[model samples]
Target chain A: MKEIALHMLDIAENSLDAGATKVELLLELTTGGMLEFSILDNGKGMDDETLKMTSDPFFTSRTTRRVGMGIPLLRQHAELAGGGLKTRSEKGKGTELKAVFVAGHPDIQPLGDIEGCWMMLAAMHNDVNIELRCSTPKGDFEISSELARQELEVEHLNESALRTELKRLIRNNLAAIGFTDGKIDKTILNS
Target chain B: MEKIRSLADLKKIRDENNKGVELRKKGEDADKLVQVKVAMATCGIASGAKETMEFLADSLEKRGVEAVVTQTGCMGYCYAEPTIEVTLPGRDPIVFGNVNVKKADEIIEKYIKGGELVDGIIPVNYETIDSKE
Candidate 1:
């Protein structure tokens, strides 16, 4: 919630909740000079009604709180940065959410350390198949848990120091996006 | 700044950074790390996954377990919001539903370091259908 990575993370969490086994999470510098981030999931997509209602801060199907606000927050962030967010979904097919942040826009927030994103993700959804890709004007990087397992000869990437490796992968992606100085706060990592 | 075109480059840099920490090189067993998965999906949050994850992270630090607490997508058992799964060394992972700080404490005390399973267990069914199939 405090960073763009947190919002991307929240959306990814939602995608996973939609029964997605394979989620393609992408962040790229689009040709339009905007930083575009998208999460495509093979989950149970929402109906048109829900998609239309998602932007409304008060419309949530969940019986939790009277105010539903994640989507609204994402939309506000995008608009404030001179870009926009869009979501498309089909009932039984899947869902795709794209959020664009204007390139060099003064209002655009910096992309936070992705290692935190990846660590939280690895430690969070060990069961789901998550593929995260990020590209920038300088370089690009990708992490596929399925592929990592096949290459590393391991079952999962969540435990032990393997998580550290995942953290490194995330750090590299952030560096590619010009977030070189960002390191996993050792206190958070050890915690 | 060289280009990072593949996973290999990523790994090289990753290993280089590992120099600062005592990385247990790839083939060694990771038996002591306590792995806790926090369900942070919309349903999970509606049920308080954020608070649960924070509590676990904070409490684990206090206990010196060196655990990694993270948020995850939903496990489809909406009835069981705020679900958590704990994986200890050499043991089958256990899933607990309706998890809160109290349950988290029990998990840290009984399951994480104590090796005892508490209530609210949600048996995992890996055979569930994926629409792609």
Candidate 2:
């Protein structure tokens, strides 16, 4: 939860737990220093009550433990960093989570280990497909697991060599888009 | 972003792929390979489990160890975040706690490769469904 990217990973995991077959993650940094992070999932959408209750740290439908802190913590982080979070869902449809933060806010956390996040998502969920798109003023990049699998001729994304190739592609592309060295300000927003 | 046609080509970009997405499928037989399960729940991640898992996968691959690395939910040990269970073929699984990158490397070298138990072994206080009893 220290990094906004960690929040992104946590929110995406929630989608996977909800039985989502397809998940889309979008990260955009605007010229005005606003970083928008969004995840769209085709899982079993929450009902009105569940949607309302998700903002509360103590309210979790999971029986494994009593508390679920992903959503609440993300909300807290976003708000504290001079931004906010919004969620929309409908029963039997899907859910979308969007959070925005100020890129240069002193309290804003670093974008922790996004490559690790994407790799975990791809490797852990072979059946589920994920599409990640990151955009900045410098450039934009998109990676789709389905496309990578097709091109690499691998049955699963977790194949050692293929996974390595996919990770390389993502990192190279992100670097091209100026997301290098984990510093988003000088590379993307300020530049 | 070139196409990988051979193993050498794959090796050329291995470090760039440090995420190590070598996830194992459920119900797959672990009889012939070392089985590693990384705890990736909220607590585990907050404590840097992702980096440890990545290191395990990369180091094992580099050392030519045949292993299946996968992620699992909480093992009810939040106090010991970033835990891992290593099960050699035909042996009882050993749970290691607080496994950072260094500890993971040591586990791979001393215990996994040398067959000598290392530090960080967590005693089993509760029985799981697959426990041998």
Candidate 3:
């Protein structure tokens, strides 16, 4: 699980470097007892040969770097957790990354603070469109940038204040939806 | 154990608990709630969404914002990572990206609390035909 999220961080970084303008994130916990994580992006997707080679530990597209282990790490973690990772991409359309974790697996960690995940994205990529959604047995939750910009009254909403407020909102929403058993102690991050 | 049959039963249990003291009853309308969305899309994570998300959740809890933080699949743009969206009651949701730990702190300090826009502003370029303007 640790490596799964870490792989997520890595692939997403690749997309960012590709000059993507929007990214979509989805986590679906199906009634069939499957936990799935998929990231889709409009950045320059990989070619067919590269896609096939990404899983190989020794294969990497980086010309300057000798070793690229992100994809291999993802494969290792997913398989260790009794899950698997799949990637599909086109040169222009985009790429899709999916990983599935079996329910009740001891290795699969609970999806951590996802709301905070988006906040982190906002802090890093301030100029891109981002949409995130999660669906579970309980219900569904969604967040979008275009939606927030339209609801405000200020002529120009302050980005810094918006970030803080978004964090607060995500925490509350997660609690409301039972994303976590209880509120995460806020003191940990700031201190 | 017998299943909980109604809202009243849930409330009764809440009333009996010490952990949730003075807590508002569930099943009530979420009229005044705040909703925060984290873009865990590939682009977002590559830009350090993981650390940023952790920071925000920890920070928000410290602030007692009564909010929810979660990871989302993606929104299509790959350049701006670690993206996030904020939604307050009766308001539109806001999205931001290109985040790091320091940016997360600034976000918590300025955007979340003060309702302000910060440095990272992703320019939306993709468009669909006959859209709502």
Candidate 4:
């Protein structure tokens, strides 16, 4: 993927396909020049064998195709960025995928359209209670679909205008936390 | 760039938008509206499917087309990335391949609004998980 946000999104889709009703994504950027996300989903998880083979690009749980590259690509990206991916799951339980990356590394991908990422997740899957929790060294912020729905008094979250509003909302919150695109401004965090 | 840390701020923005709540409420009768599904798998995103999805939603909303545009997994058409499925009311879903922003708009205008078929359709020959019955 060209961006970390896309990778998160791709992985989150797997969670949705696994019958996840609630997905929580936590993105944290620390002063140590590390960025990571913990995507936790309440869905049908995998057995030990399936989880082990997830790093192999050819292994997939879906019968749609013979190849599954989402997890493998994430692992490749994480390793290239001087970090790695860790997944823990159990059959009939849920799954938690944590990927860490050296944000300042040259191979590290840009965080493309973080707001757009959240917007797509919320708008596309209205039945799913998706939440984005962003934590920086300075402070923390969260964007929740349920709360936004209640505040807006709108039933569906897929409104195009509402997506525009959501993008602006996410962008402003990230800016307030000293994050521009994906990288956080260390100077601002210090102040 | 105003800080939008609270949900009330979001409501303010929504209320300020030109056609916000009423139009959203109009979509409550989902079965009566046009349905759009964008394929957003790994290959699709790499081929700019996200942009197509966003554009379709925006264009549909601007044209005031009562459509529910949602994202779906790969339609097993990775060779033709960025595919989409359009389902008019009480109609079977037709899959279109290689859908960039331009193609998505054309689909919206021609197939969706005008009820005309385009050239990028990949005939749905494969069976789905739910089709095994």
Give lDDT tens digits, candidate 3, residues B1-133. 1222223432333334324333223214554656666766434555666677767766776687666665665554445667777776777776777777887778777877777878885555543222323
Q: In terms of docking quality, how is candidate 3 classified?
A: incorrect
lDDT of 2 by residue, A130-158 (tens): 87888888777776666555554445666
* Per-residue lDDT over A1-191 for candidate 4, one digit per residue giving the tens place of the 0 to 100 score: 78888887898898888998889999988767688878999999998988999999988766666788999998999999999999999788899999998867788887778889888888777688888988777677888877777777766677776788779778878877767866566575444
**Mind giving the per-residue lDDT tens digits that candidate 1 earns over A82-189?**
999999999889999999888567777666645556555554565677787876555567777666655555455544455656676667556655556542222221
Shares of reference contacts reproduced by the candidates, in order, are 0.17, 0.10, 0.04, 0.46
* Range of the 10 consecutive residues with the lowest summed lDDT in candidate 4 chain B: B18-27
Candidate 4 has an fnat equal to: 0.46
By the lDDT metric, which is better: model 1 or model 4? 4
DockQ by candidate, in order: 0.14, 0.20, 0.04, 0.42
Q: Which residues of candidate 4, in runs, are more than 4 Å off?
A: A182-191, B1-4, B14-20, B23-31, B90-92, B125-133
What is the Cα-based lDDT of residue A184 in candidate 2?
A: 75
Q: Residue pairs in steric clash, candidate 2?
A: none
Clash totals in order = 0, 0, 100, 0
Q: Give Cα distance to truth, residue A74, candidate 4, Å.
A: 0.7
- For residues B1-133, write the lDDT of model 4, one tens digit per residue: 2334676687687677646355445456888899888989887887888899889988998997888887888777888889998999998889998999989888988999999999998887666544554
Candidate 3 per-residue lDDT, tens place, A1-191, comes to 24343554566666666677888877776666666888888998879998898788677554422355667766666676689999999998788888887745677655665655565554455466666676666556676544443343222222344555665665555554445532222232123
Candidate number that wins on DockQ, 2 or 3: 2
State TM-scores per candidate. Answer: 0.64, 0.85, 0.54, 0.88
Q: Which of the predicted structures, 1 or 4, would earn the higher DockQ when compared with the native?
A: 4
Q: Give per-residue lDDT, candidate 4, residue B75.
A: 76
